[model samples]
Target chain A: MKFGPMKPQRRNRLLLVLFVVLAAASAVGLALSALNENMNLFYSPGQITAGEAPTGVVIRAGGMVVAGSVLRATESLRVDFVISDLQGADVNVSFTGILPDLFREGQGVIARGILGRDGNFVAEEVLAKHDETYMPPELVDVLPDSHNDPETFKGGTRQ
Target chain B: MRFFSLPDYQLIMLNWFHRLGAPRSFYEISGRLLPVLWVLSGLSILTGVIWSLGFVPEDYQQGNSVRIMYIHVPAAIVAQSGYAMMAVAGAVFLIWRIKIADVALQCAAPIGASITFLALVTGAIWGKPTWGTWWVWDARLTSTLVLLFLYLGIIALRSAMENRESAGRATAMLALVGVVNLPIIKYSVDWWFTLHQPSSFSLGEKPAMPAEMWIPLLVMVLGYYLFFFTLWATRMRVEILNREFRTDWVQRLVVGS
Candidate 1:
C-alpha cells in the first residue's frame, strides 16, 4: 500500500484551505435551515392573547402564575392555572401531570405545548422558572411595575 | 500586499508554537507538568464534589436531583471546550505539520467523546426528575448529540486509515470541519425555546446561582479541565514513546526503569 506524501506543497495547502472554507459554509447553511424549522421561541401571555403565537405549534408560554388561579382535579392529576403577563392579559394553561415541587401560585412558570382550539394553552410540560438565588430574567421582565423592584417581586424569593 | 504580514508579537507566538510542536519538547515539558495537573485534578474534584453534595443547600425546586448539576454542567462545559481544543490542535497539525499536534488531536478525541457521553447521560438523568422526561429532541440536546458523533467520527477515521500520515491528515480535516458545530451547540438554547435551560454561567456576568452553589460548580469545572490535561499529557507521553521506540532516550529510559 502506498502512503500519501508527508510534505505539503503549496497546492495541497490551498486545497485544504478551500475544503475547510467550503465545509464551514455548507455546515452553516444547513444549520440555519434546521434552525428555521425547529426554532421555538417563548411567548408572553400578551403575545398569546394578541394572536401573535401560532396555533397548534409547540411553543413556550411564560409568565407569573396568577394568584388564586390554580384548580387541581380531585380525582385526577389534571390541573388548570392562569399565567399573567403583568400587562392585564392572562393565558389559561391546562396541564395533566404532577406539578414540579416549585409550582405555586404567583411563581413564574413556562408551559410547553400547543394552543388548543378553545384558546387554552394545553401544556405537555410545565417548568418552574427560577434559579436558586434569582428569578429568570424573562419572568422578571414581564412582572408589572416590578422590573424596577425585582427584589420585591413574588417570584424573586431567594431559596 | 505582503504575502505573510503577521505582526511581531504573532511571529514570536508562532515561533513558540513551532518549538513546542516538536514531540520531544512536548514530551519533556508535559512530563514536568503532569504531576501537578494530576494532584490538582484529584484534589479539586474531590473537594468540589464533596462540597456540592454534602454542604450546599438543596435546590428550591429540584431538591436532591439538583446535585447532579455539579457533574452534569462541568462535564458538558469540558466536553464542548475539549472539542474546540482538539480542532485547534488539528489545525496546527495541518497548517504547520506538527507531529505532536496530531498526537494531541488523537489523544483528545477519545477523552472528549467520553466526556460528551457523560454529559448526555447525566443530562438525561437530571431531566428525568426535573423535566419529567428522560429525553427530548430539544435543540440543545440534539446539537450536543451531534457533537458526540463528531468526536466519535474523528476517532474512527484515524483508526481506519492504514497510513499514519494520511490518517492524521484525514482526522485533522474532519476535526476542523466539525468546528462549526461548536458554536451551534453553545447558542442552541438561546436561539430556540428548549426544555434544557440556558446556561447559568457566563463571563463578565454575575452567576444566577448563589455563591454556595456556583462556587463548587466553578471548582468542579476547573477540576474537570485539569483532569483532561492530566489524561491528555499521559496519553501524549505514551504516543511519544511508541513513535520514538527506536530513539536512544526511550531505550535508556526503559533500561533505566
Candidate 2:
C-alpha cells in the first residue's frame, strides 16, 4: 500500500484512535506509579539491609535461605533462619508457623512480618519461590554441585 | 475478479482472503475443516497429556507437581493470544465495517474468557504446592486477573447494549484500550519482584528446559491453538447462520442441509 494519505475522514478516525490510546496509556501509567511499591511481592534482603524497608509495619522480605542457618525449636513450631541475597548482609528471620514444603536451605524464600529494631524479621508466614529452570533429579545429580555455595550459586534468579 | 494484473501467488492469496471473509464462504469452508481440526487437536492433546504426565521425569525441585506446567502454561499462552485475536477482529470491524469480523469478535469473547479462567485456576492449583499460597497480590498475578476481568467486561458490555452497531464499536474500543494491559501482563514479572518466575520459554531465546520436557509442551501448545480455532470457527458459523437466516442464500443452505 502507498504511504500517501489525503482522506479527511480516515485521518480523523486515525487521530481519534491515537487519542484514545494515549489516554489509556497515561491512566494506567499513573495507576501503576501509585501502586509501585505494593506491586513488588517482597523486598529483597539487600533492600532491607539498605534500610529501604520500613520497620514495625508488616512487610515482606525475601532471599535465599542460608544453608545450615535454620534453627528449629524442639517444643514449638518456632524456626529461625538467616536469609541473604548472597551479595549483601544477611537478615535473620524468625517465624512461629509451618514453612512451605519447598522451603529448604539455599532455596528462595519470602517471609511476611515485621522487622524489629534489633534488625531481625519476625515472620508471620513464609512462602517458597522456585526458579524457571526445570530438570529431572537424575540430571541434577549429574551436574556439578556448583549451586551449593550461596555466592556462586546465582541464588534466587533475581531480575 | 482481478481489476489489474498481479503475480499469480499474490492474486490467489488475495482471492482466498476475501472469500474467507464472507459469512457463507466461511461457514462452508469451516464445515469441511472442522473434522480435521478435531482429530488433529484431539490426537495431539492426548499424546501431550500422556507424555507430560507419565513419561517425563519429575523435576528435582518440584517432583510430580511439576506436571501442572503442561496444563497451566498452555492455557495461559492461548488465553493471551485469544484476547489479541479478538481485539484485532474488533478493530477490523470498527475500521472497515466488516460484519464477519464483528461476528468473530462476538464469538471469541466467551471462549477466551473461559481459557483465561482456566489459566488462573490452574495457576492457583500449581501455586499452592510450590509457592505456599493459593494467590498473591504480585504484579504478574494481579495483571492476569485483570486480563480475566477485561474479557469479562467485554462480554458484559456486548450483552448490555441493544444496538448491535454501537455495541460492536464500544467493545472494540474497550478491547483496544485493554490492549495496553497485554504488555504489562507479559512484562510484569520482569518489572517487579513477584513470586511468579519469569517465562521459561520465549521465541527469541532457547527455552530454559530440556528437549525431552519442552517437546511435549510444544505439542500441547499447538493442540490448544488448534482447539481454539476449531471452537471459534464453529461458534462463528453458528452466529452467521443465526444472523443471516432471513437471507435467500441462508434459506437455501438450510434447505440443502
lDDT of 2 by residue, B55-116 (tens): 99898889899999999999999999999999888777766677999999999999999999
Q: Write the per-residue lDDT of candidate 1 for residues B1-257, one digit (tens) a residue.
A: 34157677866776766667777777788888888899999999999999989987776556687889999999999999999999888887787677898999999999999999999999888877776567767678988999999999999999999999999999988888888888878887666555566677778987766677788889999999999989988998999899888998889888995
Determine the C-alpha RMSD for candidate 2 after optimal superposition of all C-alphas. Answer: 2.8
For A29-144, candidate 2 gives per-residue lDDT tens digits of: 89987887777888888778878889999998888999899999999999999998888668999999888989999888889999998889999999998777788888887776
- Name the regions of candidate 1 deviating beyond 4 angstroms: A1-15, A18-26, A41-64, A84-89, A106-114, A123-159, B1-19
Q: Show what share of the native A-B interface contacts model 1 retains.
A: 0.21
Q: Best TM-score goes to which candidate?
A: 2
Extract clashing residue pairs from model 2: none
TM-score of 2: 0.93
Error of 1 at B131 (Å): 2.0
lDDT tens digits, residues A38-154, model 1?
Answer: 454467677678787789888878777888999999999999999885667788999999887667777667788999767799998887654334332334445453222122122
Cα misplacement distance, residue A11 of candidate 2 (Å): 4.4
Task: Identify the candidate with maximal DockQ.
Answer: 2
